[model samples]
Target: MENFNPDFLEEENDDLYEHFTFTVGKGQSPLRIDKYVMGKIENATRNKIQTAAKNGGILVNDVPVKSNYKVRPLDIIRVLFTHPPHENLLVGEDIPLDVVYEDDEVLVVNKPAGMVVHPGHGNYSGTLINAIIYRFDNLPNNSSDRPGLVHRIDKDTSGLLVIAKTEHAMSHLSMQFAEKTSEREYVALVWGNVETDEGTVEGNIGRHPKNRLQNTVFLDDEADKGKPAVTHYKVLERFGYVTLVSCKLETGRTHQIRVHMKHIGHTLFNDERYGGDAILKGTTFTKYKQFVENCFKVLPRQALHAKTLGFKHPKTGEFMRFNSEIPEDMQQCIEKWRNYSKYQELEE
Candidate 1:
C-alpha cells in the first residue's frame, strides 16, 4: 500500500503507531519475518522487531504475525511500533502554548494554526513537540520525537489535543482511541450548501497514487489499496455559496474529513491540498470572485478546525471534554460569508 497520511498513520489516542511497512518480493525465499524485515528496514534491531511482533504490530496481509512467522513470497508485511523513528534529537523550544487543562497524567493543549504536530520530512524544528518538550520534562512516548502525543491534527488545522504525561496514561489513552471510544469533532466551511442535517461518509482512504501529497477515497476495485475510514457530519449552518459543518470522526484516517467531504462533492473551503481553494460552488459575478479572493486572503489555509474533543480520563473513570473557539482567520471568513449570504437573500 502507498504511504498513509501522517496525521492518520496512527489514530487519536493510540500508543502503537505505524511508521513503516515492507512487502516481500515475488522471488523472496521463506525466511523468519523478523529477519526478513531487519534486512529491509534500516535502523531496526532484532529486539525491537520481536517486541513489535509480540505487541501485535507485525502484520502479514493484514493479519498479525509473530516474529518467527515465515515470510513467503508476495507477503505484505507492515510494522507498527509505539515510538517514532529516531531522527533528529528532540530539543525543547520556549514557544507559547494555549493549554486548556492539565493534570498529573495528561495535558490538553489548543494548538494554533500553522503548527505541525511532529517533526517529519522538511519540518524538523519549531513544532508542537518542540514547544511541549521545552515546557515539560520526560513525556512518555515511543514513536518519532513526538512524546506524549495521543492524537494529531494537520499543521494548518487548529484544534484540541491531549497528551499523555505518564506511561499508565499513555497506555490507557491509547486503548481508548484504538477501541473507538473517544469523541472528536471538527468545524469546517465547505463550498456548496449541504442538503442534509446529518450524514455519514464511509470509504477506504489512502494516498493518491499520482499525487503522494494528497489523499483520496478508494471507490475502485483495488480493495487492498486503502484503510476503512468513517466520518459523520452535521450541517451547523449554511451560507449561500458555502456551508459550515460539524464532522465527527469514527476512524481517524489521514485527511479523512478532507477527503470524505470531497468525495461527497462538498470539499472544505480553502483546503489547498484537496482543491477546495478553488471556487467549487459560487456565482460567476466578478464581485463574488473578488469576495472569495478576500476570504482566501483572510484564511490562507484550509477552513477546518478541531472544535471539540472528549474521552475518559486516564486516571479517573470520569469522562472529560474540551472545546476550542474557531481561529480568527476562519471565524472572520465565516462572518464574511454569513453577511454575504444574507445580503444575497435581500437582493433577491
Candidate 2:
C-alpha cells in the first residue's frame, strides 16, 4: 500500500525473458496494444509486437491481452522477450539444489526462499533453471525454450516443484496442470483470525490499475477482465494477531493465494506488497509493534509456502505426491507468534 519492491516482484519469472513495463500516460490517445508498444520502444515493429502478443507476452494490467486489445489510459503494459535487452543468452550456474525426488522422467525439488525459478532481464543467473541445466543433460526445452521447467513458484515462497526432463514428460506434466488434475497445497500465515474453519474464495484476479506491482480481485462486470481463480483454505492455528491456514488451490493464477486471501480480509503475514508488513490486527501498543517487528525481521518475506504437490507420473502413469517442510525463518516466526499468543501480553 505504501512502497513496493519491484526487484523482488520481478524475481518470479514464468519464462526466461527481459520484460519492459509501461504505464500509459493520461494525455495519450487510445491505441491498440501492438501499435502503442511500437510507438514507445524504438526498433520495435508492429508485427514484432503482435508476435509477442500472440505468444502471450503482451500484458495489460497483468492480464494477457491480444495485439488488437485497446490500450486504455493508465493501463499497465508489460512487453516481454525471450532474450535480454542486450541479447545475452542464459548461462548455467552450479547452484546447489535440494532434490527431493528425481528419476529418468521427472525431478521434484524443494526450492528455497530468495531463489528465482528462471532467469529474467535483471536476473539472469543463480536461478533454479540455471541449476537444472548445469546439473543435468539433454533436457527438452518447453515452448519458452526453458529446459526442464513445467511450473514455477514465487521467488520468496519456499516450495516443491516438479521438473520435466524429456519432451514426452513435459507434455504429460503440462497437460495435467492445464486440465486442473494436479493438486497443489500451500501453508500461509495471514493477518487477523479467520472466522470460518474452512472456506473457498472464488474470484477473477488481475492487476491493480493504480498499483502496477500488485494484483486485485475483479468482480461484477469487470470480472471478465481477469481470469478465474479459486482457493480453498482452512485454519491451522489461531495466533491471536495472525492465523496460520492451509490453502488448496483449484486454479494457479499468478498471486492467486495472496490476492484471494487479502480479498477476504486476511492478507498473508509479512507480505510487504500486500500491506501485511503493518500491524493490521494487533493491539496499538509499543510492545505489540516491537513483537511484530521482531517477527518481520525473522521472516522478511510473505508467510506462504507450497507445502504439497501431487500429480500423475508423466512417464509411468503412476500418481505421485510430494511435500516439503516449513523453512527455518517461517518456523521461527510461527514459534514467536505462538509464544506471544499464549502469554496474551499487550502492555509495554
Candidate 3:
C-alpha cells in the first residue's frame, strides 16, 4: 500500500506530485537501502536514490536514512519531496469561463480548447486559474500555484474538469485522482486505422532526452528511465486512414495517452509535438494531400478532447458525471473526414 499526505501533493500538469511510501514485506531480507529501494521504485536509478538519501529525502521508520542503511523486514520506508519542480506567481484575470455545475463544495467547468489550465512560465495570463480566481474567491489552493484544480488536461484539449471549493473537497478529490478511481475518458482521432477495437498500452514514459518538450516511452534497455504509464483505448469509429478512438487512463503520466498511442504507431492526428502534423497514413495523391491540409486548417491542434469525466462527490458521496461536446473546429474536421472516407469507398 502507498501512503501520500494531502498537504504534500502539488497539482502540476495532470498528475499531482507527492511523497511515496512503501511498507517492506514481512518476508523481505536485509539489504542495502539504495539497492532495496531501487528495486521497489520504478524508473529510479541508484545514483538518484543515493543522492536523495544524502539530501535526507529518504526515510526509514520516520527517520532519515543513509544510502548504505540496512533495511529490515516490515520496515516502513518513505521518499518525500515536498517542493514542486516549478511554480510561477499567479495573477488573476477576468477571462470568462463556461461554468457547467457549481456547488458549495465543488465546481465543474467545460474548459475550452486553447486555454491554459493554470499559471506557469510563459503562460502567466488568460489561464483558467486566472479566470477561476476572478470568478470565485476563497477557493482552496494546493502547494503549487494552481488553486482549486484537482487535475488537469493539456491546454489544447477541450473537456470537463472538477474544481474543489473547500479544503476537505480538495483533499478528497485529490485522493480520488491519485487512487485512479475517478473516471476520465478522452476522444481522439489518430492517423492510422487502428486494427484492434480495444487495447491497453503499457510502458514507462519519460521526457525525450534530445527534446525536453516531448515525451516518449522508454522500454527494454531504458526500462528504468521514467515512471510507469498505462492507457486503455477502444475504437469508436473508423474514417478510412484516420480512426476515432476513446481512451481511458489507468495512469496519468504526462502525455500518457498521446505518447502511448504514438508508441503503437497511431499518433493522434495533427499533434505537432509528436510528429503527427504531416500525413503519416493514406495515399500520397495531390488531392488527398490537399484534403488533409484543409482538414488541418479546420482543426489546428491535436485531435483529442476530454469528453467525459466521472467521480463521486467529495461531500455528498454521490456519483457525478459530465460530458462536453466536441469543439466546432474538431467537429468540422471530423465531418470532412467522414465525407472523404465515403468518397474513397465509392472510388474503390
Among all candidates shown, the one with the greatest TM-score: 2
Local error of candidate 2 at residue 315 (angstroms): 1.6
lDDT of 2 by residue, 318-341 (tens): 999998999999999999999888
**Residue runs of model 1 more than 4 Å from their true location after superposition:** 1-20, 24-86, 142-145
Q: For candidate 1, write residues 1-348 as lDDT tens digits.
A: 244334532443167766667776565678899887776554568998999888778878877777889998778888888776434467888889999999999999999999988877567788989888888898888454458888899989998999999989988988888789999999999989899999999888976755667888887576566788999999999997799999999888888999999999999999998899898998899999999999999999999999999999988889999999998999999999999999999999
- For each candidate, the alpha-carbon lDDT, in order, equals 0.86, 0.85, 0.84
Predicted structure with the largest lDDT when compared to the true one: 1
For each candidate in turn, the TM-score is 0.78, 0.78, 0.75
True-vs-predicted CA distance for residue 108, candidate 2, Å: 0.5
Q: Which stretches of candidate 2 lie over 4 Å from their true place?
A: 1-88, 345-348
Q: Which residues of candidate 3, in runs, are more than 4 Å off?
A: 1-88
Task: Give the better candidate number (1 or 2) by TM-score.
Answer: 2
Scored by lDDT, model 2 comes in at 0.85
Cα displacement (Å) at residue 65, model 1: 24
How much is the lDDT of residue 155 in candidate 1?
Answer: 88
Clashes of 2: 0
